[model samples]
Target chain A: MIHALRISLAIIALSLLASCTPTTGTKIAVNQSEISKIKSIGVLVKKDEDFSVRLSREEMSNTGAAFGLIGVGIEAAVRRSSDKDKEEQIKPSLGNFDPQAPLTERLRFHLQEGAIATSEVTDGGEKTAADAILEVTVRQWGLRRCPGPAPEVVQAGFNVNGKLYRASGHATVWEREELYLNGDCRPWSMFRSEELANDILPRALDALATKLVYEILYP
Target chain B: MKRLIRHFIFALALGLVLSACVFSNANVNLAYKPVEGSKSPLSTVKPLKIALVVEDQRPIAERESIGNKRNGYGSVTAQVKSNSDVLTVFSDALKTELGNNGHTVVADKEPLYDVMLRVQLKRYWTDSVIHFWDVELVGTINSDFVLGKRDGDKPILSQPGQGTFRESRQFVTDSAYENVLNGALSEFVRNFSRDPNIIKALQQAGQTATPM
Candidate 1:
């Protein structure tokens, strides 16, 4: 009887652990054979407009929802104040942001950490020369107020679309257009505005940069 | 008895804990925004009685979806579709723009029309391709219009009305999709009506109906 009880408890515990864990989608590591073909890689981000981070209330409304009509105004008020605070924190970073800086910086850092030599492909570098150049065209980017991993919680959402091309021969290597929807389970968030600007938003960008490099290096 | 009670409690707790992972599907609807139609009617001495007929030549009636988002385990979290009759919406937009510009809008078989304009729609699609982090909602409308006698084999004048737009947003909603697509439609109607050639063709058609 004790053994059966123990087994039941163990099964339940395992199931609970698996379900509650924050998910990191399956990883695709770069094959050494793929990386061997290129000696050095450069990152060139193409952007014609200035970078800006906007803090706006989510457009999600409960006016037509089946329930919860009473709490809508209260929720909106709370969200508004939260946005006001979060906007103040993110303002400094939003203004005069160089679109190329983070991706290039993170790419260089990762390359150096892996002992791989990667350079920045500046404007007009495509004509100059390079072994391999990852031309990143930032089509769209912004910050959002969205639901986090759990209910009744809000997170500062950093959204971006990084379109990449292996520009040495100008052949397309990797291109994934980002069509975003809110309420997806994202791993990044912080409650405080200070942490959001100082940590969550930056870390999200860092992860975004890392993913771009990973895909290019692998592809 | 105590062990049974314990088991029951554990099961209840497990159910409560796992239920939080239940993600509701995102249902979406798309429509065109009521664009402030063409401000200035085509420059003409008299208000043209235009009977408009839009002939759809697109490959599909409905547009391709804005795609879907899946969780780590591969269950669908959200999906977006082009939900409405695009032809009807586009027809209404054209009518509004034409009327706003001082033209008397009429049906295809109207006997009082000074000109019969047949719009040949070639391509129209509105979709956002990704569901990951950031997204761009894109809309495109392409059509070539012909003006001549009702049963004429060839058109007197052929001109294309095309509008393509791209908007960046944090997350896309049904209303957001509608707004972007409407923006594209607005541009299309505005450009189509503003063309001086269509007006000139109407004037010239009053005397002559030669094919272009």
Candidate 2:
């Protein structure tokens, strides 16, 4: 009888385990109807903001001097400052911009391109066009620190916040932040910085496109 | 033998529970005009195609879960949902509102359509203490004109919203999801339909109506 009871319970348990299934279903995040309406109502990019070109007398005179003496150092710093200014131009005083790769591409809205120009005269004979002008007043733009730790774990003799420390007796240098001669920030190089900026500008444009679409369609 | 059997059962149950919670933090749902009325312009216009892209990296399942928790006034759970889902719902609600007002609606995959809508959900973060999801939704409309156009066409409309949703609510209570979606849609549609060019186009089409 004991053996029989054990077998019965085993069968019941097996069946229950087999029946277990993950929760699943099709949830339409955005249905067909909604997609259609937006497509029909085209979105326009906003006008680019007027950036006041600011330069110190020394910096202005150097036009070539900063690049000449510092090599790429001065250029990088100026670029960073200019980038900050450009970032502000894209932000809106109120509301928000969309942040998606695909949707942004579809709408062709971009920050670098600025908001859609609503005031531009269309070919149509109508005096006032566009149902409502979407004015995107940018508040914040640019690369902000993405928080969290490194994706991988690093260990050495002594564990110090994912860094490894070596004793004085060690012959070879340990690959660690404190042990490294240079800091986390890369040495300023114009060639490399320009390359990076090229990549970033397009991405910013992509993000801009996303933001522009959201403002127009949802405005 | 008894011990072995009990052990097996416990292990099985444990596995099932783990899988259930793997991506259990979200939900999604659609909200349109509760009933058709004068505001439904989409009923007259042919539906177009639009694609909604959610910004966050979460799987589609969690995104849907977040969307399902919305209400007319917008609920806390709805806000707790992901940013992408929130934008998805808002854009759809806006479209529905536009449709109700007599604009034709279509699918995003379809070509040769009148308008194309692209929406992006951005900056979605949740505050566990208060149980709220802070989000910004960005929307844009794209239109192409083959003739009499400048610079190869451009976007027709762009809009964005910064809104907040509470984390919890009574089972029967309405939340911010509904309120924001409804409000945003109303604003977008009213402005879209009132455009003089759009109105003129529609009027011209109406006048030229001959058996197609």
Across residues B147-207, which tens digit of lDDT does each residue of candidate 1 receive? 8766474777875556555665544455654555666676566446544456567777655
Q: Residue-wise lDDT of candidate 1 within A1-219, one digit each (tens)?
A: 999999999977765454311111112333445556656667676654432323334442332122233344455566567656654555555444454677578767765654557777677467634456655555544454332123334333333444433445555444543222122223223332354445554565565565455444433
Q: For each candidate in turn, give its C-alpha RMSD to the true structure in angstroms.
A: 23.0, 23.8
What DockQ class does candidate 2 belong to? incorrect
Which residue pairs overlap in candidate 1's backbone? A179-B130
Each model's DockQ? 0.01, 0.02
Q: Which segments of candidate 1 are over 4 A away from where they belong?
A: A1-219, B1-38, B41-45, B61-84, B129-133, B206-212
For model 2, residues B93-154, the per-residue Cα lDDT tens digits are 65665555554545545443444444444333322211121122211111111111111245
lDDT of 2 at A100: 25
> Which structure among the candidates has the greatest DockQ?
2
TM-score of 1: 0.39
For candidate 2, what is the total of clashing residue pairs? 100
